[model samples]
Target chain A: MNPPVYFFTDFSSRGPYLGQMESAVLAVAPQARIINLMNDAPFANPRASACLLAALNDYLPENAVVVAVVDPGVGGSRKAICLNIGDRWYLGPDNGLLSLLVSNAGAENCSLAGLHESYMKAASASFHGRDVFAPVAGLLVNGQSPDTFPLPVDGMAGASWPGELAEVIYLDGFGNAMTGLRMRNLRDLQGVVVGGQLVKPAYTFSSVPAGALFCYENSLGLLEIAANGSNAGRILGLEIGSPVNPHISPGRSKNP
Target chain B: MNPPVYFFTDFSSRGPYLGQMESAVLAVAPQARIINLMNDAPFANPRASACLLAALNDYLPENAVVVAVVDPGVGGSRKAICLNIGDRWYLGPDNGLLSLLVSNAGAENCSLAGLHESYMKAASASFHGRDVFAPVAGLLVNGQSPDTFPLPVDGMAGASWPGELAEVIYLDGFGNAMTGLRMRNLRDLQGVVVGGQLVKPAYTFSSVPAGALFCYENSLGLLEIAANGSNAGRILGLEIGSPVNPHISPGRSKNP
Candidate 1:
């Protein structure tokens, strides 16, 4: 059975961009199962998108082919690459979008850089996510080998980036704020301080009262600030890449 | 060959909700091609979603299984249904969400009233999209027949609703405003009167200068108001369900 293909992009699902990308993939791999992991990744901010992708990676199927393109650098000199991180495979650009995933996968992971010039030459000046990466991803999920296509590399382009960022990486449609810090980092933390408001930890949204701002472990295993039945992003004046300071409760054990 | 499944919903793609729904479908139909046709449908406005779904249907493949849920009346006594419109199949609540599709497909179409009580009985109070529709859609694309599930009906609920809604049904992430009126309805129309601004028609965004407000036949064949390379929704003061008046240019032929 073919592993499902997941699409993660900053391409907002407006216009015909996303549809054209999906058509390109289906044209090559007709029998493939495609899941749109996200199309609304933060626009043009690859650094923020990288952290969101890493946090969201837990939900993606292991060994699946992921086509990630948060590329603000399309049509530029940026290299198109593929990464084989453990069992999962990713086809995207080298613009730091896949950095966290590659870095987190550790020493055993490998990247194949420089998509064929012939493929890039024929790709649209603006939409490589559709013309170039989609076909490459389609071919890969249909069983093409990385060695047969690109130059292999031991390190990814942005693999040297930080393990965890202190900035808000994504704000969902419901106004929940997803930070770069992992939930595992909250062992000694009692809450989050954002927009001049100190919010406490809750197990889930239901644990907090309506309109109450709270921090909780989201399903993505990230520290997220949300309001019960409300828009926390609007309430706390948070946006993508907003700086957040985690607060440690007095007497809380760091290792607990 | 299994038919592709498309999800058209008001359920914002923010949390684990959409992911969990996808997991349910994949659990049953592991090889299914699932497309997020639109996750950000106008919330709780099934009338608007119905129009948007109808306009968007032109892009979906025939015989596809579409799980459309815009039920503001979820957990209420509203009936869950299955509609066989031509070769396409739709599973959703009967609260006008699928009405446009049903009405547009004409008399040859058929509907199955009342999803099995056992299915609805097990559904969560607030999320029938995951509990009832997802599993049902999975079984369907995997070859289960509508005949084995529910009672047949000649007419669907809300099928008598108007063909065109002169209001904004959705605002895409790019801030383009998609009206419920199809371009076909504007035979004599020269422009639209939206937010007291007379917006003229253009072929494409690039046809006009940057920040110039214009209306065009979008890929979905709907009259979408956009500003060249700018946020149209913000500039025009338009949002989901905002009303607009179509005006005819004097001396212009209606047939044009």
Candidate 2:
């Protein structure tokens, strides 16, 4: 059986864009399980969203097909591409949004390809999420090989980007701040410094007192700034791309 | 075949709450097609959310099970109920959130019922969406009959409420404001007076010039206020539950 398809985009709340995307997918694979992983990706900031998409990779079900769209340059000269990382499939614009995913998947095991522009020849130039990428995702979920629609180029535009990012990537509804820094390798780290505030690491929300600010490994397996019973985003004045400094206590090794 | 399940809630944009609801549904029916209709419903205001949920009902597929949650009174004396409106199933709190649906379905065809509270005895008093409603929806989707889980009452708490509402029930991501008035019975209606501004109607976004405010039938088949190229919600300072007075043109009969 084909794995479920996960949709990640910047469509945010409201509008017909998200629903139309689902319709396009259902028209092809009527029974496919589609998950709206996150619709509120940092708007138009694909670099920040790239880190978010990478950090979210750990929470996805096995062999999921993720159709990610954080494209600010949709109708322009940017290419439309797909990447097959092991059993998982990633589809979206050729912007740097897929950089971290490709880098984390170990570029050696992944192959990048693109679709024919003719597929979207009739689509509105402004709404490619509904017209172009959704249909492409529908086709992929039906077991079509990415190599069947090859691009003129070999690698994605941002394939050479770094593996980990240190900036604030996303802010959740609860005001928790998620940084691009992976929690995999950090050892003996005392706290995270955001806006000059030292937030100590706790095991979970209940580990800290109500209204207390702290840092912890979130369900997505990344270091997130959170308050036990309040909105951390509002208190910290955090935003996408905000600089987050991971404070390592003296004599602690920086390497994982 | 079971129709897809649509999720409407006030969970906002982040947290494990919404995802955990999907997990509960998928656990019972692994291949269930779950759609996140909207998560940012008006917080805690079920009357306003009921109007929004009612307006959204037209856009849902046939026989779709909607697990609507806008319960501000969770873990209180409020009841958890389900309504079978034709082929569609609506499940959530008894705080008038499903009132519009029951009223629209004409009450007689819709029989009110509730699940045994023992099903939720193990559930956190806070999140019945994950523990109770989702599991019930999964059972219904897998062909369990509504008659199997009957409530003590025959009618919903808000069954006798008005069919049409004249309030701003929801605001979309594009900054459009959606009212609770259904367009089906609005004949000879020229415009809507919102915040003391009389906005005219247009066929589509392009029908008016840029930054023009107009009321039209939205994708959800409800009257909505929108700006051609600008944010209408920002321009009009509109919000959920904002009073909107519908203007029926003089000398035009009010008949449908």
Candidate 3:
């Protein structure tokens, strides 16, 4: 479509593919805008990375080529992938670091970048963020033929990540902290346990007594845990980099 | 709620109102968890403050109070407000600051606190973010009466505030500085005409050929002006803490 484009990399603990990706983008599509989405999720947690990926549609520029990398199962037996969903393309490990985007992007076709002799670079250990993912994305951004670099396959052993992590990604002006918990989860609080304490009767901050702990849907539509006139993060020991855990309620349907 | 809450306020920006507002919460509710929401929105332009508001929703605790203080017309003539949107309540000025949320919060039955004698903690000449808005929001969290503190007005004034401001706000890691452009006010093929030099379109570091000029959308979804391979903030002779005048497309609409 000849629109502006960028690369959104996850520079989490896995680090970044800045040099190679930058080189690839500069080598060809030098006119396309390139950006680093983020490389700061947890270590080797594809699910967490996926959660971040889900927020992309709402916050990222539409039509931008998002090349993300949060692969924990780097190297080894894992498979690298390029997934085209709707009008967008995502190049990363097929380990569901992109699973977070399933509900939104809806993968149309996924091809595995088989580690053949010509496909991969002479890389180092645990540095795929720089060596592999970055170059692949930049090459794609430059409109290079995908088949020119690597062959397509199916199924790479994805990483196993299971946790109810709702972190405070940012805070608002009015003192409202927006968590990773979306509106769907907040409105359906069944069995919520924060800091060894059970959150009962989840509702508005004002729904209960003044001092009572309350859980409700924040303006951004996420489930937030708060109290009237008190600091929930400090009092509950939930810091800026902490994750929220949502326990499964017994005898309840998963869907709300 | 009993969750940890943190606000991104600066020291002295909210001043006693921050603690006092927290105190107001404890005065009645006695057990509200109040965290520090930042008291800095680059002089508290409600529109500038609007960006902080949205970001906080992404990274805030499940339930917390964010206290922002970007009020320029603090004690002038603007009215304090509280919005009961979805599950969270936002407290701030009526002027277009919360304009972004009016449609989402069901502006029809939205709530506002009338000017109160008791809740007015001897407000300063121009520090509503510290004196008024903070304390009232604190009381709301502290389990105090929302209607008791102030009278409810239909809504605040200045719904359309485009072409009113004259500066830049936040910047990105790429040094692609985001201007205070109201999103809708940008036009196509609009050249950057600052000080008579026509800005060149350098999509990436290479396209600029000399890394002199670049333009693109920053990570925060705002149109940005940047310099390749160099800090545009420095090269362009602009400072993040300062302001700038941007050239917009004539047909661009203004954000409310």
Candidate 4:
């Protein structure tokens, strides 16, 4: 059996876009397993989303094909590309959405290639996620390589972008604010300050007083601001692109 | 190959509940195709949810197994049951969640049964969707029958509930309010009044002026109130359980 195909897109969960893309995958690989890894990514902000996407790398198994689409330039001149990073494959627009993942994997560990021209010819102007990326993923999981031309890492968009973002990149259902800064890189920090509030670190919600604001490393290992037993995002007035500053003690230096 | 497993639950899209339940289905039937039919069902209001579920019946294919989990009575004395309605199978708590679907299929066409005792014994108090319903669905799709006892139609909760509900039951990603009233059943009505605003019927969004509120039959065949390119739900302040009263001319009477 083929490996599962995972979708990570800015398409909100309630729309028909996700379902249409799933149908496009099934059209090519009828027996393939599909998972909606994350449908509610930071909308149309690829630079910020790249950091969150990299944090979710541990969830993708070897041989899995991930269709990452946060393209605001969908109908523009942005090139469609595929990247072979580690044992998994990523099919998406050449915009900065996949750049952070590629940079994290290092140049030697990544192979970048432009998707075949035929896909673009057949794709609709606005919805390349359903038209281009999803079908490419289906074919990849079916063990058939879509035609492609090799591209240099330097030519990729957002190749020089920062590895981490200090903004709230996502808000989960419970209204917890997930920042793009990885916890591993911020080990020296005691907490984060958001919306003029000092949010201290806690192991979990239960470890803190109910309704108290706290920050912790979420399952994806990102620093997330949450309120125990309450809507932290609403209480703190946090939204996508909200700034989050590291709170380090006077004696402790930030991660260098 | 087994039929696909569809999940209809109140679990919001951003949480771990949906993903964990998907994992459980894969564990039992490794090759089964899982689709998230609907994750954001009206939270804990299965009576309202039943009307929405019955409207979505057209999406299910023959032999498909749907795990309906709008369960608020979890860990309670409510019975776990399975219903073979039409050619599709449904596994959920007997807390009126699946009652409308069963009634829609007619009593003679439905076969209601209690799930095997072993499933209940092993299921966690909080999440039977993962432990009980998901595994039972996987077993059915794989052609293995879990133990069950026959049940009469009258034994089902909400079995005698109204065929249609005239309240806002769901809101889609675009904030369009979806009422439980089916459009087919209200052909004689020119429009409906929601939140004290008169909403006229139109074929689609483009037919009306931009930002104008109008009602139409959504793809699911239910009455939905939408603005041309804006959020009608937000503008009108409509939410789940908001009453919708049909507006008919003096010559026209309500559906009989």
DockQ scores of all models, one per candidate: 0.11, 0.11, 0.03, 0.11
Residue-wise lDDT of candidate 3 within B72-174, one digit each (tens)? 4444455666655544566665565655545334456555454464445565433455456655655656555555454433345544443323345654456
State in Å the error of residue B115, model 4.
19
By TM-score, the candidates rank as 1, 4, 2, 3
Q: Per-residue lDDT tens digits of candidate 3, residues A178-211?
A: 3566757433456456655665544454455645
- Residue pairs in collision within model 4: none
* TM-score per candidate: 0.62, 0.61, 0.43, 0.61
> For candidate 2 chain B, which ten residues in a row score worst on lDDT?
B146-155
Model 3 chain A weakest lDDT span, ten residues long: A154-163
**lDDT per model vs. reference:** 0.79, 0.79, 0.51, 0.85
Q: After superposing candidate 4, which stretches have Cα over 4 Å from the reference?
A: A13-16, A249-253, B1-9, B14-28, B35-38, B41-256
Specify the CAPRI tier of model 3: incorrect
For residues B4-95, what per-residue lDDT tens digits would candidate 1 score against the true structure? 98998876875446765786688578877788888888877888888988888888888899999885556667788887766788889978
lDDT of 1 by residue, A101-194 (tens): 8677765455555677788877899999899888888887788764336553535566678868777888877787888888786686777888
Indicate the worst ten consecutive residues by lDDT in candidate 3 chain B: B8-17
For model 1, report DockQ: 0.11
Which pairs clash inside model 2?
none
Docking class of 1: incorrect
lDDT tens per residue, model 4, A201-243: 8767656776899998776778889887678999999989999
